[model samples]
Target: MARYKAPTTRLRRLALQLRQLREETGLSHQQVANETGLVASTLFRLETAKTKPQLRTLRTLCDLYRTSPERREELEALLRAASEETWLQPTAEYLPGPYAAYIGFEREASALHNFEPSFVPGLLQTEAYARAVIAGSAPKASPEEVDGRVAARLKRQELLTQQEPLTLDAVIDEAVLHRLVGGKAAMRTQVEYLREASRRPNIRLQVIPYETGAHPGMHGSFAILRFEEAQDVVYIESSTNDLFLESQEDIGRYSLMFTDLQELALGPEATDALLAKVLEED
Candidate 1:
């Protein structure tokens, strides 16, 4: 249940198309900038999807590259899409660009496999737990902003109970259970929620113990989302940056890694028992 922002999606697609056309033409970023009268930094931004290009700028790039009429029309369509507002526009203010893209991906995904080594995944977090986690991570955020984000996250959980629920397979590191993210009471409730969520038919919760020494996901946490109409994407998030990998090779590698991690984690019955033991200790 990631937060949504509308504008970034269109911008991202346009950027990707621009980069692809440049690559096909074998033009360097500086070369494209020089020929199109656009700044090198701007070209770079468009290619890497850091910013949205104006309509005129997009037309200029297409003209410089001698793109076909059909292709130009397609790019314009992308631009138009970028200009449209999304349903989650109210929550767009606080969300960063990459996160906005993640929300878009999450909304379209048919199934999601998430592995979290640190905090609990957002889709499963209770309101109080989510508030504490966000506040701790973003200390400068106003209370109202935190509440908005919490509300957004809670709204995302509706996908779980929808008529067409997204299949969620979550692999959590055992350490997350003991981290005490939101104080004793909040953590207690969170752990209890995890136990309750595990009861759902569409959700599969597994725990990778500390003893699973040197597993493939030891480097970082990632999620591989599978969509019905689109290709699978692997999302990797860090403290300050996030990456979305759509290339088949990269997605395949992460999928393999997820499978391996799933193999090493405790089975459902054993995982439930372990969770119960932790709750008792708490």
Candidate 2:
């Protein structure tokens, strides 16, 4: 239910440092704005990581805070890292801000656990299936927008193949196996692709059967992304807005929920069998 304009992890760290610096100076946001001749709301957004900090703004704050040489060097390092262009940058205009942030998280994460109660997880989806999903979900989207989205989705899959590949443990609802997205033939191919993808050492796929009845995932689909250097984050997508939960409490709760979903879902062998059965039905 919590929603906000999400920022990448480095930006988050930079925001915290900037806020701490301001706190050390014992200056209120209003006071800082008066000193720097910038709007208070703009300062507030910088501290909250809601907006990207430009070089001039960063330099202005550093000067106002009288930052030490050592600390200033660290802040500059983070600024460069945070502003570095990513693969998603080219297609960002086609994506929702939060969704773009989600992919950014995916690209940097060491591991990810996802729960889907509806269609296939984006990373595991085929090109045709992804096209169908984009078209169906955003009926108002232009042909170019759909293509860009689909391209982005496929690009996300590269994480599984990149050096030190991302470890993905995805648990999907049983209902998804029967829900046709593209068409019968397309669905069959998609399922077949899943069965093959599950064989990879880095990918672990499971299914939560209907027999389990109502469970934690009944709330909705979500993913837990883990990073080696940064903190773990929970991403929850919705029709209207998306969420990026970084608090320890939210991370702990979502991590526990993903564990519960994994238990409720079938194991590796059983999931393989189920996918095979679904393919037969198709």
In order of appearance, the predictions have TM-scores of 0.74, 0.87
**Model 1 stretches astray by more than 4 angstroms:** 1-4, 7-84
Give lDDT for model 2. Answer: 0.90
Instruction: Estimate, for each residue in 26-140, the C-alpha lDDT of model 2 and write its tens digit.
Output: 9999999999998999999998888778888898999999999999889989999887778876677788878988988888889999999998999999999999999999999
Candidate 1 worst ten-residue window by lDDT: 1-10
Q: Which candidate leads the pack in TM-score?
A: 2
Clashes of 1: 0
Q: What C-alpha lDDT values do all the predictions have?
A: 0.84, 0.90
lDDT leader: 2
Cα shift from native, residue 150, model 2 (Å): 0.7
Q: Kindly give the stretch of ten consecutive residues in candidate 2 with the minimal lDDT sum.
A: 1-10
Q: 1-282, model 1: which lDDT tens digit per residue?
A: 344554444566677789889988999988887887888998898887667778899898898889999999989998887777765678867676667667777876789999988878889998888999899988999987788778778877887899999899999899989998879998999989999998999999999998887788778889888876446788998878799888999998988888988999999889999999999998
